[model samples]
Target chain A: MRVRKLIYLLWATAVFLAACGGSGKMEVTNAWGRTSPAAAANGAFYMTITNNTGQDDKLLSASAAACATVELHEMYMRENDVMGMRQVPDGYIPLPKGQTVELKVGGLHVMCINKQQEFMIGDTIPLTLQFEKAGTMEVTAEIRDSAEMPANMPGMQHGGG
Target chain B: MKQLLPLFAFLLLLLAACQSEPKYYGTLWPNPQEVADFTLTGTAGPVSLSDYAGKVVLLYFGYTFCPDVCPGTLADLGYVVRELGRDADKVQVLMITVDPERDTPEQLAEYMSHFHPSFVGLSGTEAEIAAIAAEYGVFYQRHEGTAATGYLVDHTARVFVIDQQGKYWLSFPFGMMREQMKADLQNVLRRG
Candidate 1:
């Protein structure tokens, strides 16, 4: 009985720690970066944001030391074959209660422009995402090694194909 | 009358099977036309379409500074090429710079090397690129971007497949699957 009670307490503590980000409301995971060539002026990163705030929240902005600045960007198909990208006009990504929002390539991404350093293969770049309720959370975006890069090639969507 | 209808349907099926034309994943030009021979600078100076006469070529219009869509498309093309195994050499993926001022021939070479060794990047003067782009139905325009990114270029991201005889064949739009691409390429390779 004593051993079982201890196990339950440990589990509860672990959950408490995880749910205690910012105002104790969000979890960020699967942050990854695309490989940046030596002379590339910009780099892109993607990740997932889970809102546990029990209320709707918004991601207002983001930043990273690896680049001079960053913006929450999205890609949309302008025509049958042309794709255009721009900053999220509403200025924030919506994170509804109990839902996970994914930022992906050819869709939503963190566009790090004016690179201060090259994100070579197998390196990590620290990204600071600012949320309305969650405050600021830093996530490491790892550029995977060549042999094991995730097959992130996905289709583009929104505003027509 | 029912018996006759069944015979009629069987005959139609047989006829349809015999007359089926070759299929491709991307949209085919209504009237495939021969593209004019054009020259652009490669890592090795002054390369032309005629250089790879008998091989299939995939042409792309993109810039090195483009962080998302361009590389995603290139990675898909690279996946198709690599999956072809030894036959990969029969095909080529060439990227022409939409931002010629930004993408140097050396930078293009290094960028292409990352996708696949056989992938090639081309550069030329602004006038030269514009002329070629106009003829090929690829369009690009310069514009101001956010403070983070100094500028951006909006361009059509279709991959045009040029056959061995130098005719503009099917064009693959952005986000085409590698399997479909591979199947279409194999069909082109076999038919030629």
Candidate 2:
């Protein structure tokens, strides 16, 4: 228990510094993919991207062996009382210097199309995200029943637009 | 300021969360229309809206193949119902598949089991679904996508609530918080 608390304390501090330090690093955290039932044709992943690279960066695309095709998708209110989802028109997500972006449920997400197999809880989806300047970042997203709710940490919550 | 007094009282009542004719967070119809009873194939065979009479019925137009939005809504509803405990029995969540060809009864049932056992998924012929969807102001159309996805359907994502008397009561927009949903449901039950 003490060890866990210490780890939390360390994590809390790291998160705090990331927000205030403006460290020249590209970091991705809280990456998770939603579990897919047997009949589901695709899956989705959400995460938080903290880009303190001191320069603008763009997330171009993502690829994974778990899925044949991956696309950056956005869900929006299309018309009167309707929600519509479409691939990002720009085909990339802009990460301004020192800004944190949250890919959340019912909002911006990574669409994993043509699921090779059903994803169950505890399974991990290894991803290679291509970036404009940050090169490629390898992220392992755990399959979870639901995305984690944005905690009370600073710079963690957004309108999911 | 005579009108202002009533408005002030209404705001106070809302803040107090009084049981006396509480206004729900969902969108209420100016004129509540009675919903047409429709039958669809459920896990236990043909199920009709009237079969769930005397309960607050939430009709969601979606399919099992949906990855982000539908699952988010289902997960939120599951959380809401679970929070209600035994009182959840008075509420029914029905996900009517817009992708009938893909969402067979058995497949939908399996998907709902992942969220909450009490929730039911229903599917029917394309004609049958289109008719029911039209009656409720839901519009859906299939659009071409990648070969892997077969196709994608763009449909209304609102959740329509049917009162115990089978009238269109209120509609919850997508991305509504679970707490708001729970409160609205409790208020409906209380008023009933």
Candidate 3:
């Protein structure tokens, strides 16, 4: 009976990991980048990072050959009704154990500054993300336009899409 | 149980009625009040708020150098104006730059054209712009940046809507969806 119980627990753990799309130490999914608007030189990239490991992980930095520089930044609402954005000063994004962090539009994102090439639709942007515990993981973010962005984020109520 | 069914139906109807009330995504002002008139330099020449007396004006505050929020707001406005279709003719978009020191009238105009050909960009002296912003309750402050990253400005992001009668009608918060804006604009056009 004890062996059977242990087997059941292991199966349940597998099911939970599968449900969360977490395979190993860290899983990055739904990675995408936005094409710059007309005449704009800079663009942004977004993705979801799920920490599946037992230990907490920190995203130290990111790099891409497509841009001169890549920085982790956050878009936050400031006082006096201002919308503010700046590079994360500490230079690391935290991913706690078993937590999923989303880097999306109008929130946390990767700033692709002074691009060497244009980010067009259907293009795949190769990015190397460095994590403290998980080490370096390469990701490819699909380039999409603003119209293709999902509006289902909480508190986003725009009509006439 | 049979009698309770009517009570439940009545309660559901009341809930539906409450939800049916015309909902506005933006902050609804109590009444339409005269917008503080101001004159600023446009691409062509001097422009005044009163010049758009018969049109609905959507005003946004930001700079051309803003990579994210400003552009996002402009894109939202473009979506709104384009969604309005023919009624778009009656709607005007004006982007007032907070960084007038660098954003000349010509630069503002050129940037506005990239978003929408009909969009107008306005700029003025630092004091002039400050006065206008203060009157509209917009607070802005500059944040210095390193050599690689240029300086940034933190300013109000709400879109103020001026009705056709040239009165301040409503103020839409940042992230207010395009569909709600379209509906409000349609209602305004219909009323006009």
Top of the candidates by TM-score = 1
TM-score of 3: 0.77
Weakest 10 consecutive residues of candidate 1 chain A by summed lDDT: A152-161
TM-score of chain B, candidate 1? 0.90
How would you encode candidate 3's per-residue C-alpha lDDT over B11-83 as one tens digit per residue? 9999999756355667776666888889999978999999888999999898876666676677778778998
Docking class of 3: incorrect
Estimate, for each residue in B51-134, the C-alpha lDDT of model 2 and write its tens digit.
999998989999876789888778888888888887889989999999998888988998887788888999999999999999
Reference-based TM-score of each model:
0.81, 0.80, 0.77
- After superposition, the stretches of candidate 3 with alpha carbons farther than 4 Å from their true spots are A1-25, A38-41, A115-125, A143-161, B1-22
Error of 2 at B94 (Å): 0.7
Best-to-worst ranking by lDDT? 2, 1, 3
Q: TM-score of chain B, per candidate?
A: 0.90, 0.88, 0.86
lDDT of 1 by residue, A19-127 (tens): 7642456889988887766667777888988888777899999998888788888877666567777788786888998899988877788888888876776798888
Off by over 4 Å in 1: A1-24, A116-122, A144-161, B1-19
lDDT of 2 by residue, A80-102 (tens): 64656777778899999889998
Which candidate order results from sorting by DockQ in descending order?
Answer: 1, 2, 3
